[model samples]
Target: MSGFNNRNHAVLLPERLARFGPVEPGAKVKVRIPTEHRSLPFDQAIWPEEAAVLRTVSRHLPNVPKVLATRRGFSVQTFAEGTELAAIWGSKPNVKGGVVEGLASLFAALARIPVDELPKPPAGWPAFGDSTGFIHCLIDYTRTRVEAPAHARYGPLFGALGFPADALRRFSDGLPRDGLTPRPFVLLHADLHPRNLIYNEEDGSLHAIDWELAMVGDPVHDLAIHLCRTEYPNRGERQRFISAWHRAVRAANLPAVADYRRDLPWYVGYQRVRSVYTDVIRSVELLGPAPTGEELDARAAAVCRVLARAWAPVGLPGSPSLGGVRAALRDWAAERSEPGPPLADLRARLRRRLAEARTAFSGYFAGAPAPLPPDGPPASASRMRAR
Candidate 1:
C-alpha cells in the first residue's frame, strides 16, 4: 500500500490524469495505493486528516509535500527528487551537524502555527492547552487501537512477560494526580524520523514527506516521541537536541512551550511503554519455523532493553531481569511463534474503509484539490506533437 510513506508503495504513473492539468508529459507524476495492511488496527488518523494537513501546512512550510489529487483508497502528491534522509544517516542515527538544527527548526516551525488558522479540531481533540487531556487521549488510543485490537493474539505473550492485562490502564493511573500545566497544542509531525524526511544537499533543506501521522498535541509530547523514535546514543546528544528545540520553540513564542523541559521525561516514559508493546509484537513476527538461538537471543536482548525502560512506568509485579525476559520470550515463542490474529477479515474491513475514505474525500473537498492548471499545453499533447 502506497499513500503516506508508512510502508506504502508509490509508483510513477505512465500518464498524468487529465485533471492534473497541462504539464510536459515528461513532468513527473505518481500514484499511491493504500496497501491492505494500512487498514489494520495499527493504522489510524485524527481530525484535520492528511489532505487538510498538507494543504494548510504546505501553505506555511515550503518543504511539506502538496496533496495533488486523491480518490477513495489513495492519493497523489507532488513528487520531487532528493536523497532519502535514512540513506544519509543510516542505522546509527547521530542526526548531527547542521542537520540537527534543521530538524529542530522543523519542530519550531510547526509550533508557530496559529491555531485560528486551522479548521476546528475534531470533537474529542482535547481543548486547546489541555495538555493533560492530550496525554490521556494518547493513552486511550493505545489502549483501544494498539493494545485492545491485538489483545486476543498477544495477550498471553504480554502476561507471560509479566505485564498485567491492564498494563496501559495502570500506566494511565500513574499520571500526576494534579493535572499538568497547560501548553497550547500545535501541529505534530508524529512520524518525522529519518525515513519520513528527505534531504536535498544542493539546497541543504530537509523536507517532511509524510503527513499521515501528523497530529495536534502537546509540544513536549512531540519532542519526546521523536527522541524515543530516534533513540539518542547518549544523554548529551539528547540534551543537545532539547536545547535546540528549546531555542526554536522559544523563538516561535508558543505560549507555555517554554516549560517543555520539565515534562519531557514523563512523555518519554510514556513512549517507553508504547515501545514495549510494539517492539515485543514485532519480535514475535520475526520468529521462524525453527527459531535459531542467535535470533532468539537478539530479540530477547532488544525486548529486555525496552522492558527495562517501561517496567517501572507500567508498574509490573516485580523487577524484570534479562534472564527472566529471555525465558518469557522463549516460552511465548514456543506457544505461538506468530503474533496477531488472522488477516482475511482485517483485509476486508480495510478495503471497505478505503472505499469510505474515498467517498468522504469526494464529498468534503471534491476528491482533493487538483494541482495548478497547466498554463499552456497538456504534457501529453506536447509529446505527441514532438513525435
Candidate 2:
C-alpha cells in the first residue's frame, strides 16, 4: 500500500502475521509510524507512550488492534479486518437506531476501564486521579502549546487582520466553568470520528484505531470532541447519538455520563477555538513560497472561513475580510521561501496546469463568479483514517 504524510508519518503494509514471530500465522499486519510535528503541539509525546497505551487498552477492549511489535518511531499491529465506517457511510453516517446504539456501547466500554489499571501517563501530566484539574490543565495546554506559539508566529498578521493576540486567552477565561459537574476522568480516545472507526459488516462490530491522542480526561470532553469531529449531518442526528451515549454510559453505571448535556457545549466551543490556531498554521504552511495569485486566494478563503466560524466562539471583535486575509497571506508568503521536494515540485506542476485550464474555461463562460467557500467551516480535527 502507498504511504502518505500528514500531522504524522504513516504507511499501510500487508505482511503475514508470522513475520512478527507470534500467533496467527497467515494474518496480515498493519504498520503504523507515528511522527510528531513540532508545529502541532497539542498531542503529548507519541511513539512509545502511545504504543504502550495501545497494548494496555487492547487487553480489555477486543476491538482495539493488537500490538504485534514495537520500536522507536514505528509499530506493527494485527490489521483490523473490516471496512472503515467513513467509507461505508460516505462522510456522514446516519445515526438513527442501531448505529447509535453500537457507538454508545463502545463509549460505555471505554469509560468502564478503571483508571488505576491504565499505564501511568507520560511525565509532567497533572497528577493522576484529578479530573477537574486535568480539564483545567487541558485548557492551559491549549493556551501554551497551541495559542501562544501560534500567536508568536502569526501575531502581527492576525492582529493586523483584527484578531488580537489575547483572543484565545480571553476566550478560555470566559468559558463558563461554574456549572460544570465534577465527573471522574476516564481513558479517552480523544479522536474518535468515523475515519478512525472500522466496522465489521459480518458481525456488526466497530473497532477503534489511532490511539495517539488518547488521554485521561473528562469523559464529557471526550464525547464533545467526538461529536464535533464526526460532523453529523444535522442537529437531530447529533442529539440522537448523544442520547444513545448517555443511556449506554448510564446503563454501565458511569457517573460522568450524567454531566455530558450540561458540559458538552463548553467543550465544543473549546474545540472550535483550538481549531482556529491549528487551521491558521496549516493554511500558512500550505502556502509554501511563490504561490500563484489563485493559490493565495484559495488558501486565504480557507483561512478566512475558519476565522469566521471561530470568531463567535472566541468573542473576537471582528474577522478579517477575504481581501484582508489575501493581503496578509501575500505578505507572509513573501517572507518565507522554503523549497519542497521533487514530488511536491511535480504536484505543483500538475496543479498549475489544472488551474490554467480552469481559468480558460471560466473565461469562455464570460468569467462567471467563482463559487464561494462551503456553508460552514471544515472539521477542526484530523480526519485521516488509520491505515
Candidate 3:
C-alpha cells in the first residue's frame, strides 16, 4: 500500500508483542512515522534512520521481532509487550536486584554493537559519540541565535546558573579544538531512560526500545547516561547499578567508565545549559509569561542542582593548580580513591548536591525564569550524552 495509518502498521500487533516474552501486556511499538509537512526538526529524517536501526537491531537480535511489511513512509516491526520501567521502578519486587540484572544484561548487548557498521547520524553531527564535541556545537549555535533574542528574559536566569550566553559560547568554541576528531566509535542507543526501557515481568528480561538516535561513539557516555537514570532511586540503587555495570563491562571485556567519569562533568554542564534554554521556552508556552514564583523557583532549582553536581566534577582537578570544570573533574577522581562509600552515604551526598543545584538555579526564585526555545538540536547528540 502507498500509505498506512499508525494503528494499521503491522508492527503494532499483539502477537508480535508476545515474542518479547517477559514484557508486560499491551505495550505499543514506537516506530517513527513520516511527516507530511515540515514541523519539528525531528520529523525530517527520523523514520528512515529509525527503520534502518530497527532492521539492524533485528539482525543482531534474531529472536527479537520481525517486520511484516513496509509502506512508503511506514514499516511494521514486532511490538514489545511490557511495562515501562519508569512505571513501577520504585515498587517492591521490581526494586530488588531483578530489574538491575535485566538492565545490566541488556546494556551489555547494546555496548557490543559495532559502531562503524551502523547508519550515520544526519549531517553536521560531531563525532565522539554526541555529548563531547556535538554538545559544543549545540551550545555555540544556541549562543549565536537563541540567547540574544531572548536575552532580557533569560539574562538574569542564565547569570544565576553561572552560564551566561557569552561564557557558554567561549567554553564551547575554546574546547580543546583538537577534541573534534572522531576516535573508536560504538553504536549508541542514546536514549535509555525509564520510559524507553520495557521490563518483561513474565520472563524477567529487559528490552531497550527507541533507537531513532543510534550512532557510533564512546561507550562511557552511554554508561554515564544510564548511570544518571539509575541515580533516580536515590544513590543506593545507583551504586548497585554502577557496580553491576562495572562488573558487566569488565567481564565482557568492554571499555570501562573511568574515562567518562573524568569528562562527565562537561557533558552534564552542557546538558544543564541546554535544559534551561529548552525548559524556559516550554514554561513560557505551557504557562503564559512563563512559570514564575514557586513553580519557576522549583524548576530553576532542579536545573541548578544538576549544574552544581556536575560543576565540581568538571571544574576541580585530580591535583592542585588546574582550575575550572577541568580542575573540578580531577577533584572528583581523587574522591573515589577510597574503596567507595556506602550506598547510603553516596545517596546523601547526591541529594545534597541536587539541593545545592536547585538553590543555585532558583536565584531568580522571586520572578519569572528565563524564556528560551522549548526544543534544541536533535536530542541524538545530547541524548547520547545521556546514554
Instruction: Tell me each candidate's TM-score.
Output: 0.80, 0.77, 0.59
lDDT of 3 by residue, 246-299 (tens): 677556544435454456555555554444455443333222232344644443
CA lDDT of each prediction against the hidden true structure? 0.67, 0.65, 0.48
Separately for all candidates shown, the number of backbone clashes (residues 3 or more apart, or on different chains) is: 8, 0, 25
- Highest TM-score: give the candidate number: 1
| Candidate 1, poorest ten consecutive residues by summed lDDT | 378-387
lDDT of 3: 0.48
Runs in model 2 deviating more than 4 A are: 1-23, 36-38, 45-48, 91-97, 122-131, 177-179, 290-297, 318-320, 337-387
Per TM-score, what order, best first?
Answer: 1, 2, 3
Worst 10 residues of 3 by lDDT: 1-10
**CA displacement after TM-score superposition, residue 340 of candidate 1 (Å):** 6.2
Write out the backbone clash pairs for model 2.
none
Instruction: Look at candidate 3 and tell me the lDDT of residue 362.
Output: 37
In terms of lDDT, the poorest run of 10 residues in model 2 is 1-10
Highest lDDT: which candidate?
1
